[model samples]
Target: MSEQSVTYMDLRFHTPAEQKRKRRPKHTRDTEFSEQEVTYSHLKFHIPSEQQKQQTSTSAESTDYPTPTSSWLVTVILGLLCMALLVTAGVLGAKFLQLSHRVRRQNEELIEKQAILGNFTQLQETLKNCTNQRDDLQAQKANFSKVVSRKGEKCSLCSEGWIEHGGKCYHFSEERRTWKKSQEYCSSHNSRLLVIKNKEELDFINRLVCFHWIGLSRGGAATAMKWEDGTAHSTDLFQVKKETPGESCVALNAEGGAIRKCAEEFRYICEKKPS
Candidate 1:
């Protein structure tokens, strides 16, 4: 073989160690990475900010906790309102009860007053009826005067103690004691001693002359005869023809009905009550 060719063959069939050395993994060169790949790595590094910031962000767990529970607050407000309403209603009801009681009492009092007034009215009516009855009785008693048909002057009987028999009333007195006293009493009674002229008038006067004292004088010691009345001796009515001054005072007999002395204490016939 030629020498040059033998050397070439030996270089080509080098050892395994040399071949391994030749086949070693090459180091990554700076120029091996592309610009786009570096940029992607940078972006991945920045994306870590999201995780770190999320951890650092002051654990703001805004759990929306209501300051007061809505349900509990509603219950409290409702309870307070109910209590207020109940108190107000109770006060008003008490006032109404008091007013009703007062009204009832006043009504009862008014009814009592009305009843009393009605009783008073009834009493007044009864009193008026009684007065009317009294007037009726008085009128009946006066009926007697109307029945007697004697025509005379209508003087009040209580004041005028006598009636006009001959246009005058002659009042002789039983209350007068003596004869002179009887004369004075007759004068004060607006009458003279009773003088009767005619027989008829004399008999009428004598019928009423229960007892009287007169001025007739007695006969001489036997006490005879004179004018029986204290008047000027008149021949017209009382003087007897044969009579003379015998007695100075006279009184009437209870039985024989004649004139006697004024010293006698016999009952005298009065013409008037007083005057």
Candidate 2:
């Protein structure tokens, strides 16, 4: 062999110890690179811890405060409610005033009606009084007419069954009676026994054809003659004849007057003033 050929063969073929050392270095480098890749994957796919979730929820709650628009909407609703309450109050007040006015007017009307009723009652009383007065006047007028018709004069001065003479009324009785009885009869008729005031009256009585008892009387023979009225007989008048004892009364006829016992019965004449 040549020396150059021997050196070329030694370079191409390595020893066992040199190849083992180069392979050990390459294996260690591959193992280190695989461990680094596993670490990076774990970091990329990780879940959040309990403390991180709490922090996120707190930040979200902080953003939940009321805004300005919502506050304005609430104010508008409160204003609408106040306006409705004011309108209702105004309507109630007006209705109350109207009712009060109506009640006052009714009271006034009632008072007026009461006044009218009182006035009507007064008028009725006045009418009743006038009616009573008219009735009384009518009765008086009727009485006057009857009196005037009987006498045929403007006014009647005497009653019925009486003769008027010298402003006096006279009545003559046909029946006979005692002197006392005749006087009682005259008294019952509102008159007295015929009395002669003068000779003219005696003459006028004598014209009648009646025997009648007179009012002249005496208690005894010596006593003076007197009339029923207690007046003494005048001497100027016609004298009485035929005197009797004890109590005696005078009687007259057409002829003359005579004294007789009081128990003697005769027709009588009565006299009274005109009505």
Weakest 10 consecutive residues of candidate 2 by summed lDDT: 1-10
**Per-residue C-alpha lDDT of model 2 across residues 1-275, encoded as one tens digit per residue:** 11112212122322345555556666587554433222121222335566866776666655675567877998999999999999999999999999999999999999999999999999887566545644653564465356447665745566665655566777767689999999999999899998878776776566552457988898887898899888998867776787767788988765466888889898888999977
TM-score of each: 0.32, 0.43
lDDT of each: 0.50, 0.73
Clashes of each: 12, 0
For residue 205, give model 1's deviation from the true position in Å. 1.6
The total of clashing pairs for model 2 equals 0
lDDT of 1: 0.50
Cα error, candidate 2, residue 144 (Å)? 23
Deviating ranges (above 4 Å) for candidate 2: 1-154
